[model samples]
Target: MSKSKPTPPPATPTPREAVSNAKLEELDQNREDSHGQFLTTNQGVRINDDHNSLKAGERGPTLLEDFIFREKMTHFDHERIPERIVHARGVAAHGYFEAYDNNASLTRAAFLQPGVKTPVFARFSTVAGSRGSTDLARDTRGFSVKFYTEEGVYDLVGNNMPVFHIQDAAKFPDLVHAVKPEPHNEIPQATAAHDTFWDFISVTPEAMHIIMWLMSDRALPRSLRMMEGFGVHTFRLIDAAGKSRFVKFHWKPLLGVHGVAWEEAQQVSGKDPDFHRRDLWNSIEMGAYPEWELGVQVVEEEDEFKFDFDLLDPTKLIPEDLVPVQPLGKMVLNRNVDNYFAETEQVAFHPGHVVPGIDFSNDPLLQGRLFSYTDTQLKRLGGPNFHEIPINRSLCPMHNGQRDGHMRQAINKGQTSYSPNLLNDNFPKQAKQAEGGFVSHPERIEAHKVRARSKSFVDHYSQARLFWNSQTEVEQMHMVKALRFEIGHVLQESIRSRMLILLSQVSEDLAARVAEGLGLAVPSAEGVQINLNVGADTDPAPYQSGPAKADTGRDSALSMAVTAKANAGKESIKTRHVAILATDGADLEAIADLMKALMDQGAQTAIVATHLGSIKGENGQQMLVNGTFQSTASVLYDAVYVAGGAASVAKLKQDADAVRFVNEAYRHCKPIAASAAGIELLKAAAYPGATDILDAEGVVTSDDAQVGELAKKFMAAMAQHRFWDRELKAMPA
Candidate 1:
């Protein structure tokens, strides 16, 4: 009864409280309810569709009038401060691009003309990792080059992988958010092996192709100098006559495509978090410049729809087997940054930064990037004057009326800030198309305003199957191991089971193998909602996927093994690191001759002993030790050589670190060379085939008389990159 009396109608808010209550109610109306409510803009305007940006048509270029996309992308681009939302961790070098020949028919880009040496600032980065993250993370590597061309600055922002995770740009934010660390816990930094990432992949069927790449050895590059780069989106090459051809850009490393083992990558991450960065810096310091041949896969406009896949789909790639890559030029990264923060950290790359000839396709992803990149630079580099930064400044003259912002570097002179003003007589006027000015290809587009994906981008698993079929058995096994490790880390049984179903579409063998590792059965695809982007009221039948299409079954260029064979030659071993295990009383004559022979072949040699500093040779001569057994691991070098001397061999046999070093080198399938008493050390370390060391696949053994032959065989073995056959018998180091 007392409680009933006290429960008089709730007292009305006081005047001040009422006013604050009114404001709270106002904010409550603005707050979005994500449960059953429709998607809306930040301004609370209901969105008809949020899956695709407004385009001229289903397959047409994205229209600039799309305010929804602009606002959404503008928010995504500024989500992080100071560092980039993607590709935050990076390393850079000063270099130059040299054209092979003048072929104006393909493109009129001035930098592509023969004999022109255009200065370029090339930056390499790992996506999905912070600036402080380890460089060896198994993720997509960013390969962006800012070409300071005579016309203007052209940034070829691409990745080591030829394809992307999503087909449209509208889902870019979603893709990034899922791959990033979970919002609630922020665990598992610099990796995609988590429930959130797998959850997104399970629902997004279009990501099948990129998921294959991510779970391959390509995700763990052996060195920055050895990985290939690709412009993921299909672009256009416009000639002077305005002829447009669909083209895919490529950067084939001169050192050839190579990757470290998943185990090695993990170890390197812990041992040297800056493994790739240090390798790039040291190689440059040693005057061993990294080089890559600029290649392009050109497709005629008329033949765009002839292939089984769509050229405008970013998830699909025009295989080199289908359309051969043509060599256009060479890019050599020769100089290290003078100041990392000033040059490397401040450098901004945008796909929209193109010269006259290079232009964009209607690829939805690229179209979204065109708007996102400039917006990203605005927030990250502080305002709109980022182009004024010395690292990003164009060599060509800038005459736009635009001026003044945070960190403005240029000092403008006249009072005529507006265009067409009589004050300056339109001094900085726009040039005609023929006055070496930029002009877009006059391609006609006809369609109605729409927010939908093209039917052409529907088949998501064909190219993924093609990639699986193209991989060698060894490579496939490695991919299986990678998938096992990644999916195994996913704690959610539902997510893991869903991913297995998705993999079954790619290859039954792949899904089965990965399923076996996870101790889970491959679930049936039936009853599973494969596509989550469909509107609640819309029919999900059209969005659901069917059987994967089969076009080109396999492409050899997709396999690193085939690429290594194609690039095998004398130049293959150039800039390779070789560790020489030596100690006091080592063979002076043999060690000196071996170092000279290896260096002559462009291979760097480092003397690793039980201790640092000079070690006394058998002849009482002193030799400097570049590193110690405790200081360096076999993962730091490409090959190992044990010096021959009774005393040195005995000392190495008794040292646990030295024994482990040789064992690890053997486990990694790297070349090993030993001479006379050094063979005893190999046997003691239990290196594979040590009893028959001379006949081992990657081991070279010799007495003093055959020292020259030993060096020759070792160089050949090193050129092979790795003796993968030895992997079957490898033991954990």
Candidate 2:
């Protein structure tokens, strides 16, 4: 009977028909509204005029009957919620996470189960800034992740850099207060280059390692997706067998690590304060999901004393070369949040929020974080029930006898809320460790209450010196400049000298250079005392050695230069914004092919024309301008391409903006491409004999094929990110 009904031949769509079908489907999904449509109220009543509202007369007192005006005012009156004191400026996204393999041996966390995909919400933020602060500020970025698992919500609240400034949690407030703008003047909005910060860092020698990192390029990440994240504290990984191991969490970005030069970073802040945020948002929106691999370095309980530094020291890090990282999983952010305020703003992350198999260590800084995060939320989020917010809510069912508080969204059914109640048959019983419940490690301990830090935690300069010796020459120069800038801003000369002395303890050369810049003599080293109550003084001299010579063959895992060079070619240059400078009459064919090839390869191409309109091509075609030269600068792009037409070359040669664009790009060491006509313009602008002219080097030329080839080579050079080897003679020393 089924065969009797002859099956119709399979309908195949023609190429044009398929395209038309797609257009029709898109049009159906998105309907256009008529321009003449009348404006309506929320109730759908067409309004003839809304300007005057429901007034008695044109100039008379407005009546209370104006429901429209009342509704508008009421909504506007309550548009804000308390902003986070730290990590106030943040961007969030939704994504899924999958473990590389079963991590049951390391921990029993369900999300890290083999082949199991868990949904995650991650929020990246800048600390010590307001909601509207510039994203390019040299501040620590918060890398907080909320995993919605079957067990419960696990928040890995971390920072971009692995180490922290203070060793103890008790000093967190003091450290934060000193770094934040001074209470009296409030001069700096989101800057740490000031007197109070240097003063605090000078006293807290434990901050040396982190301070070195802060001054380095790590603080100026080119994009959020290019930065590494660290838990910043030693955590306990409890296995199913109750074995506890100290673990430090790491998030290695798939794009590798990259940073903006200080000059470029500052310029980007002025050009686009939302640079990082926009980069992330656009990447995810375009299906280029940002990814990071989760890794952990575990230290066994028996080997706790095998290292030079205390395992409980939050300021220390076990070098990756010494203790290799075990990659557990990969997190790919694929979705953007629907509502920023409800999701990004309301979501809360606490280092204390842990599931089964995850426990805390005695790291003093972490102990303080446990208290600070919860306390901060109470004040910032306006209630204890912040967990009820959709973004913060646990995926697993939650039940407790706790009574309602402000903004409570749950309603309990039973009258008897007690757990040991016969009336309700003890419905919500607590699960034991045997039944997949969270349990603290049973480590036997005995201690006398003390406020002092361990003597073993006093060797701060060794790692600081390690960091100093590890940097590449270019990175070292940046660090020196950063120190000069930060210390230069200090109003008090004494504070600057104290910092310079501290710098000398790290490296005499570094201290001397910074001191010279600040017009101060490098102060003598002040002996750092370690009160271990031993027979002899445990002086901090062994670790106070300055920079290791190039021949010393010593390298530290703490340096960004080593970290960056470690993953050089692996970084993706996709979606990197490159501004192509052009005018009305340019090499339209060469520009078109270069732009198309780059765009197809996922690199963003923005046409920077003299004005925001159509520019004539060599073949009589017209190209729509993406941005005007006045609205953009060389710093806004990863690289610059000077491909103008013969007709436009004369004007470009005389144009100050054009000259500045080329000069800035050259000074920044960004890769530049030029056609025959564009080369004339470059020559007019004094193209140095040593400069790597693409045309003379057989890289870029008039032929379309050569232009395409040049684009590929230029992209490879752009991926190098910078041409630091370029002799920038004109740049200020």
Which has the greatest TM-score? 1
lDDT of 1 at 96: 95
Q: Judging by lDDT against the true structure, name the best candidate.
A: 1
In the range 1-733, model 2's lDDT, one tens digit per residue, is 3557777855998788889999999999887574866656657776443322343322122344556544443333233347766688999999988997759898888888888899999999999788989999998899989999889999998999888887665456557778888877987889898888888887677788888888988899988998899998888898878888989999988876778778878888999999988989999999989999999999998998898777777677787877888999999999898898999988989998999989987676675566557766766677789898888899899988877888899888878878788887886888888877788777654453323456667677777777777787777888899999988999998789778877877788989988888998987665643222211323334323333233322354555556545555665578778888788778788888888888877788888878888888766888889887688888878777778577767767778887888777776666677766787655555455555444332123343424867787777766666655453333522
What is the lDDT for 565 in model 1?
A: 66
Structural similarity to truth (TM-score) of each candidate: 0.93, 0.83
Clashing pairs in 2: 586-645
Q: Candidate 1's residue-wise lDDT over 486-578, tens digit each?
A: 989999999999889989989999999999999999999877766554566555565566778655478999988777766666346888999
Worst 10 residues of 2 by lDDT: 529-538
RMSD of each: 5.7, 21.4
TM-score of model 2 vs. true structure: 0.83
